[model samples]
Target chain A: MFDGITPQLLFGQLLIGVINGSFYAMLAMGLAIIFGLMHVVNFAHGAQYMLGAFVAWLLLSTFGVPYWGALILAPLVVAIFGIAMERLILKPIANLDHLYSLLVTYAATLVIEGLIRQQYGSTGLPYSSPLPGGVNLGFMFMPWYRLWVVVFSVVTCLATWLLIEHTKLGAYLRAANESPEVVESFGINVPRMMTLTYGFGVGLAGLSGVLAAPIYQVSPSMGSSLMITIFAVVVIGGMGSIAGAILTGYTLGIVEGLTKVFYPEAANLVIFFIMLLALIFRPSGLFSGTEKS
Target chain B: MLDDTTAPLLEVRDLRAWYAESQALQGVTFDVRPGELVTLIGRNGAGKTTTLRSIMGIVKNRKGSIRFEGNELIGRRTFQIARLGLAYCPEERGIFSSLSVRENLTLPPHLKSGGMSDEELLKAFPNLRARAGSRGTSLSGGEQQMLAIARILRNGCRFLLLDEPSEGLAPVIVKEIGAQLRRLKAQGYTILLVEQNLNFARSVADRHVVIEHGAVVDQLSNEDLAADMDRVKTYLGV
Candidate 1:
């Protein structure tokens, strides 16, 4: 049964799976952070991600900006929009139940997606790779752009992890999630932190969007499709654990790829299948702690 | 004690607060001068905790005035009120369980320049130094209580609103907490504590303001408390 599959085929699919995992780690991390800190389910996360890619596309097509500039500009612009959205839109309903926030953010997705669709339409836009070369690594043709994505995502995730786990600012963030009332009573501006943390989380989604734009089509619908996978990753990883989401992202991605190798029909369903098992076994997620933001 | 020439450090007047439709504090008024230790004493559901929360701005549905250091406090957020040199140690000992003991101590920012240094605080709460690397919640109840108070001390918050410091603690720990509070008072710290433990209150506080059904029913100096013990016992039912 294994005779037909070559090393190249196995390694190639694994590389793609890891690439998908990178996006999952980034987007799901943002979702986890937003949910953990603000209790906002942030259905607009995928939409915000789509906006990142669109921002990159718009910058290129409208202003003749290159990929390098959009890479820096796109996430920043989307992060600003996220901060404003948090301040003006999300803050009003922040005191309400989690369900209300989830509904609001879900509604926001439709509105944002609708407006972008009105401008860009349903047709997918293509983005040329910034790095065009590939390195042949025995069995796999490793694209430089793919390598860059992995490196960038790892660095971004590491930086974010260090920021939240090690730094003074991170300690405040963790403490706030544990008890915001106590944090505020200690003289920290928690409301402002919520707004900024929400922005930072969405900005992560936006960064993934910029990364995703080059690999996938830059369409309004792109995030909607990927969001289902990322949410599955978040659930399996646990709702608020930072490292859980990242580790689960790559693990499930590889599992999905492996499923494709062994049984093609189960490829799409593999993640949900694993999530179901995880829910039954570890309802609190793989990592168990009343832990960090 | 040095002469208190200035106005009272905190003045809360007619502060009515609610938890949704249920009223918690109704026209509650109190004052704390510099270097004073005041306690709000009451039974359960007597709004003792509510008064502390209202002062911290944790209870948002509050009406009337809360003036700290001559600055209006009712409309301000908790953090801003805290920045005005007020700190609150909650009833449950709100500890960030995931954070190390040291992290919890340093989490609260220093609002003033001159307060207990980390070395001084470690010297004061010597047990905390041993469990410095441990998660905050993993400590014994007494240690957690010590950490809760110690967390705020190094931040230069001259005023503290401590809620139930002796709740669910051993007699030895309670005595320790009492000793610490007296030391803090002697060092010129102002505190407003909420306590169900009448003996603990009697031991540490300079004055006691009694709360009954969310209103200020009585105020007594520690000297007056001995004379009014029967009356106070009736209010507390202990």
Candidate 2:
């Protein structure tokens, strides 16, 4: 195996790894943010991601919307859908146990996936790449679309981090996460903040879905397939740590890619294995100090 | 003693609250006039904290009237009550671990005019000025208590509900807090403090309302509280 391994193979896998990591980072970040405020695991994240891709596909097929248009519209549409879910379903049950939220969102995932499957079928649909080009780096050819995905995801994640960490709005979010009652007593509308926060978190999932469509193919089951891994990524990163989610997502993605190159059979199992290790060694997560209990 | 002729800044009439089926505040009644530092004194489980919480609208399963500035506070949300210029400083201090001292200081947006400016607040609480960049939780207990009060002061709230500000402080620090409360009262701020420290309460408060089994069992001015120290101590079971 070592004899056959080359720089071309390694760098190609590395790029692929980074690309996977980008999706992981973006999706996990959304989950972390939602959980941070609402204490809801948002089991419907997979369905939301799937919805993003389907929305983009529908826009292109039905209204002749281009990739650029879908990139902006898909997340907004998903955000609206997420807002409705929160207000109508999540909000009423908010005062109940966390288990109720988890169950409700899981049911939502099933419902959304079922609706899409009935409409579009189980088979994957192709989404034409918007960039449609590549750059030769001597060792391997890197597609412009893949490069865009990585850059866009990184920028999106960075922007979110800044919004939550540096701004007054972010201070409200952080304070709300700590003690919503205290924050509300300070005259900040916490319920409204929670609604908007849920919208924003799922919107990130939609953005990730849009970015993933051309590469992964739009399908009902796409999100469910990735959901387990994303959850594992979240657990390994820590339950509610923003930085943990972003950093672990990218790190684990690369780790999986490296496994694919070195031991192809173990690639899929790698993330779960790390999650198991993290649970045993650091149950609160690797980067949970900054987040609420 | 000040005249009791004017309208009360806050009037709690038959304010009953419950945590699930267990009742906390039962027919508790009180009045804090404008510019007065009123203290709610009781033993543990006497519902002093619950009274403050019910007033802030933090306890939803509550009955009766909480009128602030003559507006009914019952049936309103916590934020709505806060927007009405009422702020609560909880027993836990309720500081955010994620926010820096500066962020925590400026976190609550000013609901009305007359809130202290950043310079004025930092000047008033000099320890906060020095640890402006530190995480809110990183501060010492006294500093955290000070920050809790300081945050609410910036929100333009003339009426404050502070719960146990000197619960775990050194005597020196407790003296400092008492001084701060006196200064705040002199500046025309009205306070409703929940305290088990009768000595501290007598030092800072204009009047003391004693609660027993969730009802307003007694009221005393500072002189009366001093004269009736043994009886007050007996009421507190300490």
Candidate 3:
């Protein structure tokens, strides 16, 4: 392994790992927020992500919208769809057991994916990079778009963190997560808050999809393929923990990336293996302490 | 300072509530005036808490009327009812564990114009000021109870429904809470309190409503309560 490994290869893999980590972090944060507030796993997240990519692709091909326009427009469109779905489908079963919600969203995922698959078919569609070209970093050649994805993801994540941790509305979200009834009795509309929270979470996933479209081909199966890994990240981070999800997601992505360099066969299995170990030892989660809101 | 001629600020009439299929409040009826502090005195499981929950719209499957300032509250959501100026401080002292003491204090949005300022609240409860950055759950029992009541006061809600504010506190703390209730009442806040402690009730309340098996069994003035302590004790099964 050492014989074949070069500085360029090591740094190249590291950058790729960070890029993958950014996507993971974004998706996991969304999952955690939705789960924290409504206790809904939002299985439709994957489908919504696929929809984001498709929306971006459609915008460019049909209406001549730029990559910049789709970046904002795609997520907004997906979020609106999410809000409607929450009100029509998720709200009714909100009081039921957690399993009912999971099954319902899982069903929604199938429906959404099936509809997209019907229209777009199984082939991958290309999304041209908005920030094209690369810069030579001494160690490795870095694509501007790839660097943009990492920087954009970090900023988005930081903004979301500030929104939840520092703002008044964030305080409401945190309190409502603990006990919605108590929060409501204080004159806050918890039901509306729930709907918006679902939308926000779904929007984050949509944003992640747009970011991934330039790097990977936009395909229907793209989201579903990544869902398992995201779920594993969420579980290992501890359910409904924002900081935990973000930190664990990046760590797992990097670890998996490094594994590909050292032991190619183990790359795919590493996240699940860690997840299993986490479940066995710290069943609550590796970061349950930070799981408060 | 009891005024019988003044219209009741909150009138609860034959309110019936259920938790799933089991009924909790069965035809419970009472009223609190604009500036009076009333206590609902009952033994455990006599629906004292249920009455408050129904009024606050926490118990969803509730029937009958809860009129606050002449506005019917039965059809309204909890938040809507709260917006109409009724605030609840629950028995469990619903301080969000995830929030800091400061966050907990400012959690509820102001519903009216007369809420106590933050400076005033801090002056009133110095412990809260000291633990402003501390997580709400880190507080002691008395501190948690104080934080619960303090949060509601910031909302400027005139009518307050407080359940067991003194239940798990020390004697000194109970007295302090009683003093706070008196001050609120003097400042024109109407309160409907649920209590198992008759002494606590007698200390701050102008009137008492005795509940038994989810209905109002008897009503008494402060004078009537003082004159008939033994009978009231028996009525409460104390």
Most lDDT-accurate candidate: 2
What are the per-residue Cα lDDT tens digits for candidate 3 across B101-184?
A: 999998888789999888888988888999999999999999999999998999898889999999978999999999999988
| lDDT over C-alpha atoms for residue B3 of model 3 | 71
How would you encode candidate 1's per-residue C-alpha lDDT over B31-91 as one tens digit per residue? 8888889899988999999999998999999999988889999898899888889889999
Q: Model 1, retained fraction of real contacts?
A: 0.90
TM-score of each: 0.97, 0.97, 0.98
- In candidate 2, the second chain superimposes onto the true chain B with a TM-score of 0.99
> Candidate 3 at B76: error in angstroms?
0.1
> Who is ahead in DockQ, 2 or 3?
3
Candidate 1 Cα errors over 4 Å, as ranges: A290-293, B1-6
Q: Check candidate 3 and list the clashing pairs.
A: none
Task: Provide candidate 2's TM-score on chain A.
Answer: 0.98
**Against the true two-chain complex, what DockQ does each candidate achieve?**
0.80, 0.71, 0.83
Candidate lDDT values, in order: 0.89, 0.93, 0.90
